[model samples]
Target: MSLGDENDGGQTRTRLPDGGTGDVYGGARRPARNSRSLITVVGVVVLLIAAIAFANRSGTGEGTSDDTAKGPGAGAPTSATGVRPVTGKDGTIPTGYAHDEQGAQSAAANYAVALGSDGMFKRDTRHTIVRAVHDPAVVDSLLASLDQAYSGTFLKNVGLNEDGSSPEGLTFVSRTVPVGTKVTGFEGDTATIEVWCTGLVGLAGEGSNKPVTETWFTITQKLKWTQSDWKIQSSSQQEGPTPVNGDNRASTADEIAGAVAGYGGFTYAR
Candidate 1:
């Protein structure tokens, strides 16, 4: 994530620094009027919406349609995995992916998770990830470019130390949660997959200018079956099918940081 895409020179979504700009979501901005009236209007709208949905379903041949979009289902248990998860790893990345569709999907999903993680900000882990997940042909160039992208200026822009470390009193947070992955194109030796993801980025601490925030995105990876496992030949990303924000109570910085530290991240597999 520290490395912006070579194909396009824009900032990487997960790695972009949020230099204490406050909540990008307008968190500090107050509504001009009380939302009680808006809530009443929304309540009426919900009932009408529910009625319309029920009528549409009743008119349809079945309760569902195959043409409907496949929403996020990455964590759903389609069935049980008869085969065991990969036991082999190249550095910290899973390796020895099966040479099949399922294996390719598994590889792509896990790679997205790794590349979008907070660890990508650090030098050593970033190198390990690039070496392990990227095709050997592009690994060296990627390392050099990524090193430049994560320069002191970029780190300062995102509220990190010159060396990409968090400040002494703050906890930096970056995480990627894959919602689902599907193959867009595939051949015996090559595959292209899209991984839908939701991510958290920013710092969590009292009076933090950049409060932990969330964003949605999709990553497309072109993978090749090399060395008996899938390796990314190239990858790109775009903004996503982001849902509207909900009315959930925002947690305090200490609460957010504690939850992150206490709850460990998963090593994703499809």
Candidate 2:
């Protein structure tokens, strides 16, 4: 039942990178602390909280649902298909998504790149990604929801300027370079792809501000082949239970900054 680890399990939940209520309830508010005295209060508070949760059905317990915010699902997959983009298309992304399990996995991999990249942080690019990677039947509705999700607050939190745009002289980009992909299952039309990746997301400019920070994340995209192309119906991300680090020396801000600024982005190939 290791989710995103190259194995198999249950369905993953797709969430807006920022908004909406997640099964993890990660964004929900914590209950206010009681003003009661120490020792007895602490013990009783636990039971009380449980009782309240039973009555309220809100996030009042430390069960699987609570723990989910910290990790991938227990029933998620551990396939190797989520790694790279498919190759040989007209550089037009989504050129040839397969129709079976393998194709669905490929679709998942590409969609992960589409969803996790800096492309999602802006309006136009977001539209392109949504249209490019989503199930067409639900694309319009998802687009509307995505438009609402990339709110001013979410962009600001991600180190973008207040307008969901990068600051002048600085380019904001987030790209996920899929290190690898694995297929967990290919039953009929539904398939799972676990894409292990390292993401670059931050402000890029010389002596400007908000230096880019890198993160390793794995995204699981559940895909369905539709209308000749694979499409993402749902997906989710998790922090790395990553590998031990090498002794690679850290690059200078100037070097890192230069790479971020001067290097042109790629459309990625298989």
Candidate 3:
């Protein structure tokens, strides 16, 4: 089973595998590190340290001049506005943005998280998510496309049951954490925003071929203000500005499952 390649309104959708292909996890286990790999990692760490030092040196000053700190391009200080996140919910997803640029960024970030979540693998929750964040004009079409994308075969490829549930004694994890967001365009009820995100995706359990792993990606959303809030009109994703892996030890499957169960996700605000 494959979700064959297709295009929808200029968005290029690729085929998702139906079998346990190594492409998703690269492999079941980490490859052995050679001397060259170690050396390269050391070099990257050295350069990163140097860059941080340089930035720190450049940032120091007696004080920021009022003239240099006043404009949009200036390094404005961020302080708490004492405002709470939007309390409205569209079937567990947040709604009711401020109808401004900041609202657009907030909407984009939250939408990215919702779209990248494990809920997307199941049929009913997938429909709820799509309807909640997408524009009315595109909701039905998007739902249809996504239903195909997350079909039973596709779910099986990622080590899920036909209905997108984890097999007994295992945990399936798919979550997106937004690192930051930027608004590239905002004008008259339309906004284009980009969200940089890191995500966890796979199954966590003994004997599971698909071990949970981390991935970095950026999502660009074209949004429109409609029905008194910002909604996604279209979106695209691309491989990330990924960083070098650190030396942290990998956690056991049980530990990962426990962490996921104990911790809840956040509602982002800008």
Among the numbered candidates, top lDDT falls to 1
Tens digits of per-residue lDDT, candidate 1, 104-135, equal 66787777667766677788887887788878
**Over 4 Å off, model 3:** 1-83
lDDT of 2 by residue, 1-270 (tens): 123221222323211122112121122332222212111211110110111000001122243222111122222233232223345452345545545444554456555655666656678877876777667876776677666656686566555765577866666766656665555555567666566766565555554334454455566566676766666665555556466555455454456657776776545434
lDDT of 3: 0.57
Please give the CA lDDT of all the candidate structures: 0.59, 0.48, 0.57
lDDT of 3 by residue, 1-270 (tens): 111112233433222212332333323344432223111111111110011000000012243323122212232223321134566788767788767655666677777677667777788987887788878987776666666666677567667899989998878877777666656677869877666667676776655566666656666677899999898777666556688777666776667778888988654433
Score every model by TM-score.
0.74, 0.63, 0.73
Per-candidate total of colliding backbone pairs: 1, 16, 0
Report the number of backbone clashes for model 2.
Answer: 16
Among all windows of 10 consecutive residues in model 3, the one with the lowest summed lDDT is 48-57
Please give the range of 10 consecutive residues that has the lowest summed lDDT in model 1. 49-58
